[model samples]
Target: MRMHKVNTAVTLGAVALLTAAMGTASAAPPAGRTPHPQPAHPVIVDCVWHPQVRPADFMIACGDGNSSLSSLRWSHWDQGSATASGVNVVNDCKPYCAAGRFHSYPVTVRLDHPQPWKKNPRVQHYTQMSLVYTDGRPDGFDRVVTYSLWN
Candidate 1:
């Protein structure tokens, strides 16, 4: 009788342990329902800037369903003179393919100096701009476009 009781107790303990483990597993959130704790990869499809306006504004529209924008940088060049800087502005957009969910971020870009043309007028100046999203990953969204500016 003593041996039988000991065996029964051991079996009951094992069953309880198994049951607890299963319950914990079942309580976990379902796939695609959990939030990503880190910034996801950024997908940049296109980036452009307009240099014709005073206090020029550069706009970048990009998306990374899994990541959030932390900062942005812009760079440009004209005739061999190159300039690069960061801007502080509002970055907001929806996920590339997902609807109803949108993310907004704040970024900063500081221009080294006003366009040389702005200070010493020039004719039809040409410039190229590129934007870089900091804290960007390579996965999550299909595409991301970021708009920025330097005033």
Candidate 2:
């Protein structure tokens, strides 16, 4: 009888604790008032391999919404691969450069070995990008900028 009573008490205590915890847990956004939606990931254009290919003056949109590569001109694009050159216009927030004026520097761009996108496997990504600063490093930037699409 005592064991049964103890078990019943323990069960009730557990139920009460759960109920309290649930009540204290974050509530869903007030009915009809939805939370702010997150920004969508920037779609990287498959310049070389896509049916509608864009070889020269292509843009690379980094999902982070900060930096992008522009004026990309592919010297040679064949067999689902490409070697290109472009300018990376980055926000150089340096000792004094981040005055809302983006800086541009020459960069070599490469695309190879298409892979499926992380969110949507139906779409493909270059999976590799090698940005080499040919005209020397910017005033406040690194010498080389390497980016892996899938990563």
Per-residue alpha-carbon lDDT of model 2 for 1-151, expressed as tens digits? 9999999999999999999999878668778885654223222454333322444454455343346677877676654566778887776655544355677888888777766566556545566667788886656557766666643
Model 2 misplaced stretches (Cα beyond 4 Å): 1-52, 55-64, 95-98, 118-124, 139-141
Instruction: Give per-model TM-scores.
Output: 0.24, 0.50
**Worst ten in a row by lDDT for model 1:** 38-47
131 in model 1: Cα distance from truth in Å? 1.9
- Candidate 1: C-alpha lDDT: 0.39
Tens digits of lDDT, candidate 1, 1-151:
9999999999999999999999988786877776423212111212332233223334443333333323343354333333334442432324534443444433333232223333224323323333343444233422333323222
The whole-model lDDT of each prediction reads 0.39, 0.63
After TM-score superposition, what is the CA distance of residue 133 in candidate 2 from its true location, in Å?
0.8
- The TM-score between candidate 2 and the true structure equals 0.50
